[model samples]
Target: MKNESDIISLRLLDQTDVVDDFMEWSLDENVSNFFTRGTFLTKKDAKRYITKFIVTHPWFRAICLNGKPIGYICVSPDVGSDRFKGEIGYVLSSKYWGKGIATKAVKMVAATIFVEWPHLVRLEGMVNIDNIRSQRVLEKAGFTREGVLRKYYIFKRKLSDLVMFSLLSTDQLT
Candidate 1:
């Protein structure tokens, strides 16, 4: 495990308590905009989906601060192809925005990957073109913007472009 900081602590989403709160987050508009889902429209659905992810994904976390759940951080394999490598996604309580929580959480996860996983050559992230805050967070986490992917993702019913960013294991800034 990496050193725990005063502002954030990351742990696997293995507890029922974390999954329970994850339901509330799923409904919050600000939190769900970037990660849209009709499957988690109800609390029961949210619980089921989150539980499945916790059980299957190796790097899902309940991002907390001051012992309270504030958000989630995930590093998972990209869908469709291996050429894209892996990517990360996160959602934080709006109250925590502008306080550097997302950036800190991402940096911690990135460092953990470099230190613990020998096969990880690189990790990437995709931020919707309109999400400047997320873009800044990725930059602060030591990822460099690669380019834009046309019609990369669909959110809330419309196709959206995304900015791709990545960090290589050899990048000393980490």
Candidate 2:
């Protein structure tokens, strides 16, 4: 959990309290645009979806501003032999677009995760090739574009590419 400003804080999600916000975002096509799945139509489905993540995700938090949820961020253990790494993902309501909230949340999550797990040396994030805004957010938070992943994901039955970005523990803030 982190609070960089009086207006914004990241807290472990409370399922009961965040259901509406989660549902609201999950149902919006624009908000879940790049997600291959998760075009839920009802609150029940949204809860079921979020509940699964809450259980499996190593770190999941609600991005709140003025006590209202505006987004979410999470980090899960990475695959392969690299125990010192994690994969990060996030989503922000379109209403909060252009507010720099995503960047702050990323910085907070990255810093807190590094401190919480001293062994972690890298954090990775993948953005759909067309999400220039998201790519900028990662770059602003010190993640470097590693390369393109060709035909990396199947979103809405269409093969799409992604831009992989990574931030190293040794990476200094830009």
Candidate 3:
């Protein structure tokens, strides 16, 4: 029997078939609770999002299990003088929570991102302080909990504290 990690894979998010799978998590308030964006309300909205953002994103990928997309992961690199660092983010279907799939996907990104972007030295992940599950995902993926950023930025229309985590190019993926 294949374990979750064994079947987990990542791929570009440009395919047409992913729209429905994308909706599974994209529409779930539980999944979008900590995201900067609000939950998508319809397939038309979800498709627009995929076309406008995911398709154009430089480092975004669909998190697949047994060849089906169940979520997504991406690294947004800072431009110009801050180009050495990138912020990593991910979202998985709630059905797969607590199964280590997110950690595996994060580890997969950490293992290859530096190589893919040779200039990148740091991969950062920020989580809402209230989102303990996300914090654990980063920790399990080998990120170091740097510190809390008080009132870091407005999240979902409110000032929110964020826990910052990072994994450097020299760091080993756990």
* Worst window of 10 by summed lDDT in candidate 3: 1-10
Error of 2 at 172 (Å): 1.2
Per-residue lDDT of model 2, residues 17-135, tens digit only:
54678766666778778655566787677677767867567788889887788778988787674778888998888877778889989998877788887878989999999999999
In terms of TM-score, which candidate is strongest?
3
Per-residue lDDT tens digits of candidate 3, residues 2-97?
Answer: 473459899988647446888888876789887777777877877788789888888999999888898899999888556999999999988888
Model 2 spans with C-alpha error above 4 angstroms: 1-6
Please identify which of the two predictions, 1 or 2, would achieve the higher TM-score against the true structure. Answer: 2
> What is the model-wide C-alpha lDDT for candidate 1?
0.77
How much is the lDDT of residue 44 in candidate 2? Answer: 71
Query: What global local distance difference test value does model 3 have?
Result: 0.87
What candidate 3 gets wrong by more than 4 Å, as runs, is 1-6
- Ordered by TM-score, highest first, the candidates read 3, 2, 1
**Residue pair clashes in candidate 1:** none
The Cα error of candidate 3 at residue 84, in Å, is 0.2
